[model samples]
Target: MKSLLFHRLALSKDKKGVLELSEQGQEIQKADDILKDPYVLEFLNIPESYQFLESELEEKLISNLQHFLLELGKGFTFEKRQYRISISGKHFFVDLVFYHRILKCFVLIDLKGGEVTHQDVGQMNLYLNYFKKEVNTEGDNEPIGIVLGAAKDHVLVEYATESISNQLFISKYQLYLPDKKQLENELNKLLDDEHDNSASR
Candidate 1:
C-alpha cells in the first residue's frame, strides 16, 4: 500500500506517472510485495455504489477495528487515527497509523476517496521519512506506507449521474457503490486480467 491503490485493475503503474519506491540494494520485487495488493476493505461494508469521503471511510474502518485488522493480516495493532508529526515547524497528520509487530515497523495509511496521484505517493514517502527521523526507534525497520485509495474510473463516474429514459438520477444513485460481493468480483476479475497479461508478456 505504499502507493496509491490504483483503480480495480490493481495496476502498479499509474496512467500519469511512474512509481518507483525501492531503496538501493533492496529487492524491488519484495518491496512491491510489502504492499497487500487490493488491501481488501470488505470489512468497511461500504457499498460499491456509494461514493464516500475519505473521512467517512476512515471512521467506518476505525469503528470496525477488529475486522480491519483482520484484513491487514496478523500483527497489526492500531496505534492512532490522525497521528500528527511536525516538520520544519509545520504540523502534518497521517490519517491512520498502526504498528506491525511482525514487521517491526510503523504502518502509515493515507486514505484517498478517488484515484491516487504521484504527489500522494511523495507525501507518504515524506511521512515515512518523518517517522524514520522523529518517531521510529533505532531498532525499528523503515516505516511502511500505504495510500489506500479507490482507483475509480472517471468515465463510469461521469456517466453515473446520466440516465436513460427508463431511470432517473435517483435510480442511478441508489445503484451506486456496489455491494461487497460485486466489488470483490470486480477486483478478482482485474487481478485475473493483469495476471494473464503478465504471463503473456
Candidate 2:
C-alpha cells in the first residue's frame, strides 16, 4: 500500500509537469502568431491606427464611446467631453480631456474633422501650455496633448512640434467600431485547432 501511494504521487507530479509544459507551449505559439500578424506587427511599432477616421465619430459619439477608449490604447480614461476652459475674456472648449493618474498629468485632446494641420497641433500645444501653467499642481507632471483628427501627416506633426517642449501625440479617431468581418477574422486567427480540441473535452 505504501509503494502504491508513492507511485500515485509520482504520476500526479508528472501529469502536472506535462500540463504546465503544454500551457507554456501554447503561450509561445500564440506569441509567435501575434508577431507574424501584419496588423499586430504594425501596431507593435505604432499602437495608434490611422484608418479610423473614415467613420462618422461625432455623430455616433454616445454609442461608440467604449470602443473609442479601447482604440486609444492603454492607460486612458474618459474624463469629460466638451470641457470648458475660460481665459483672457474668451471661452475655449476642449473636445476631450482626461487626467492620467499614473502620469499625473492632464491630457488634452482636440477633435478635428479633416486632415490635421500645423495650426491644429499648435492649438493643442497651446492648450497643454495653458493647463500646465494654470491647472497643474505641484505634484503633477507637465500636461500632454493629443490631436485627434481625420488624418495626420507624420512629417507635418513633427515639424509642428519643432519648438514645443511638451510631450505631444497625434492619433486618428474612428467613428465606427471594428466591422464584423475583421473581428471574426481576428477571432479565427487567435483560436487554434488545439484550443478547439481542448474545448471539446
Candidate 3:
C-alpha cells in the first residue's frame, strides 16, 4: 500500500519537521510537482574542482542524455538544444528545451556555470513569454522556465522572481553525488522527532 501510494505521490519531511508530499495525491498539477530542488548530476563525472563552461556542461548532458533525463524525473521528452528564438533580428538561444508529456508544457532550461543572476532569471522569463506567445499551440499549458546554476542566492532569487507572472523557477545542480550517510542521519533524526511528537500528543 505504501509503494502504491508513493507511485502517486512522494512524502518526506523538511528541516522544519513538516511532512511534505510531492503532490496532492495521484497526479501532477504543476511544474513543482515534477521538478527536483537540487538536481544530482553525478553521472556527468566531472571533477569537483574542474571549472567547466556552460557549453561543455550542455555537451556532457547531451552525451549522457538517458541519465540526464532520468535525473530530470519522469514525463520529460527532449525537444532541442540551443533552441533559437529571434526578436527584432536578434537571435537568442536556449540551452535546453524539453516537453513534459504529463504537464503538456514546454520546459526551458538555461545553464549557468556560476551563481544565478537577475539577468539570467529575466532571460528565462523572456523565453517563457516567447514560448507562450509564439510557440505554444492550442491546448498547451503555460511554458515553464528553469534557471539552472551551480549556486543560487535564495534572497536574490526570491526578489527576482516574486513579481514575475511567468512560470519560472531557480535550481542548483551538483556534479558529484551527495553523501548518503549524512542524508540518512538527517532522515532518521526527522523520523525520531515525529515519533516523539506523536507520543507527546
Residue by residue across 82-122, what tens digits does model 2's lDDT show?
77778888888788887765566677877776788998888
lDDT per model, in order? Answer: 0.63, 0.58, 0.83
- After superposition on all C-alphas, the RMSD of every candidate to the true structure, in Å, is 12.7, 15.5, 4.5
| Deviation of model 2 at 177, angstroms | 9.4
Clash totals, every prediction: 11, 0, 0
Write one digit per residue (lDDT tens) for candidate 1, span 64-115. 9997786565577899999988888998889999987766888888888877
Residue 152 in candidate 1, Cα distance off native in Å: 8.1
- Between candidates 1 and 2, which one is better according to TM-score? 1
Evaluated with lDDT, which candidate comes out highest? 3
Candidate 3: list runs displaced more than 4 Å.
1-26, 180-201
Evaluated against the true structure, the overall lDDT of model 3 is 0.83
Highest TM-score: which candidate? 3
| Ranking of all predicted structures according to TM-score, beginning with the best and ending with the worst | 3, 1, 2
TM-score of each: 0.61, 0.57, 0.82
